[model samples]
Target: MWRNVRRPWTAGRLYEETLEAAMASRPVDAEARLSSPPRASILLDAEVQPMGPLAPAEDIRTDPATWDPRLERAYYDGDLRAGEAVLELYSRGVDVSRIQRAFSVGAFGLSRLRRMVPTRWSITAVDDIISARLRERIKTYDWIPEHRVYSLEAMGNRWVVLMSPGVWTYESIEAWYPGTTWNPTEDVAFVGDWEGPLGRVGYAGMGGCYYAARLAVTEALERERRQARVLVLREIHRDQLMPLGVWLVRESVRAALRGRPARFDTLEEALEEAGRHLDLPLRFWLRVSETLGGGRQETLSRYL
Candidate 1:
């Protein structure tokens, strides 16, 4: 109709039109673009909190060379659940340490997925499972009547455990010195804490030592048939250049708990006594501690 509607198609106009057309078109894979990545499957199906500690395994052979064929068969059976197998061995009265060693050596787990777990992880996992069980039992018991403090030094680590008469609660505070295992660059003391009923939000900053100490304290409380609010203060000195596995903390606290604890009539007295054994000022510990600091604030509110 007219002389061929002649309009210049400038490069800029062509590009702009093309871009607008493309933008107006529907997405080719809208579903795929909007969807999130699938979540990973969990390996273990057991409850997060342990129901109870495994029964001691009787006459259990820990050495791989000497293990019973039936036990090995049971662990490798496709039908047998890995967590159930672990609990079975524990129920059989197998020492938890032995069970942990078995797991470390790849002696237990699903037949297809069996593999060696790192010793540190194995230790903490076992400790956590057992501690959760103990916590349940300890919570039912009565709280200790008085504040008590226990102190010990070993493997370049000094431990001071202050226990107050109350329902079951625990907190571990660690002071790391310059040149120590995890604080190599620090020029001053560094403090880290794991607190609350839910425990630390993630892996403890002080490593497996936190779980080890928790297990030790739980064991002591279980033995005494009492519950209490526990505060564990650990000081890692500069001399501790080498990383000793958390067993040192576990054993040292165990030993301290085994010995007589210094008695105090009040929480203030207990903290004051524990202060004598620590390098940091008592105020520093109190200020940084969630349990202790919060308790102090609450107490002061009453007087005000």
Candidate 2:
């Protein structure tokens, strides 16, 4: 009777279970604040379960906008690969989030080869795929004429995107303040990863944030048809109490890039401007940043 009643959890169920577990296990007052219920009834960490058979929305089923030509072509083609399909769909103006959702459901690929992917894996994979395609094209474009710094602050997180005239290289560093979600100790925690002109080989130590920020910067460069060495510095303050998703990094970076940048004639000047908005010192950023090394000026001056 027990065996008959039991059933294997689907991938979506497993994912939700894992996420809830992580949230519940976090040792932070902020987590408590996040899950705290208000006077008015509101959904918090709630899952919706349909009581009867589920059906697609009429707009989604009948609307012509729901039909993605690129995805349709890739879905039916036996020869079209997933990566190529993603790039084509992206080039044709499909939303990144939409692509990620479709890819997670195995919507783009040969019919026989299709399979579901975990949501987190799908998000990271799509970011990496799109960024890689953009990187190749960006490398062929001319270098940015000057050093540029873009900054934005959201949800107690500060982002500084610094781009300097050079061949294609990228780096992302996150400084977690003391008492923050990831850093409960008195000391701040710093984690970073970098890649050269040829790009990285294995997974970045910084994980999804690395890929997300990379995608944002590459998209900016591709739009300008320019190349540059980019360094993304994110500082998560104590007020940022809990962990939000990597979308924070991606969307914040995109917003920062859209704003007018503080331009400079040299990398050193750009670093100086970027450091003004950050809690950390310029020397510290230079210490951890491979893209903006302590001797970055000396290295670039040789080529200049």
Q: Give the winner by TM-score.
A: 2
Estimate the lDDT of model 1. 0.66
Query: What TM-score does each of the candidates earn?
Result: 0.69, 0.76
Residue 146 in candidate 2, Cα distance off native in Å: 0.9
lDDT of 2 by residue, 1-304 (tens): 0111112123444333322332221222211212233434332210111123333221111111233555556666767778988898898887887777667766666655666665677788999999999999999999999999999999999999999888999989999999886777898789999999899999998888899999999999999999998989999997775566677778899999999999999766787799898998766777667766545567544322
lDDT of 1 by residue, 1-304 (tens): 1111122122333322322222221212211121244344432211121123233222221111334443555545766665666667655666656666655544555665665455677777777766767778898899999999999887777889999998777888888888775575766565555655545567766567677888899989988999899999988887765665666777788898998999989876787789898887777777778777674686533322
Work out candidate 1's RMSD over C-alphas: 20.8
Go through the candidates in order and give each one's C-alpha lDDT: 0.66, 0.74
Model 2: residues >4 Å from true position, as ranges?
1-70, 294-304
Report per-prediction Cα RMSD to one decimal: 20.8, 10.0
**Candidate achieving the largest lDDT:** 2
lDDT score for candidate 2 against the true structure: 0.74
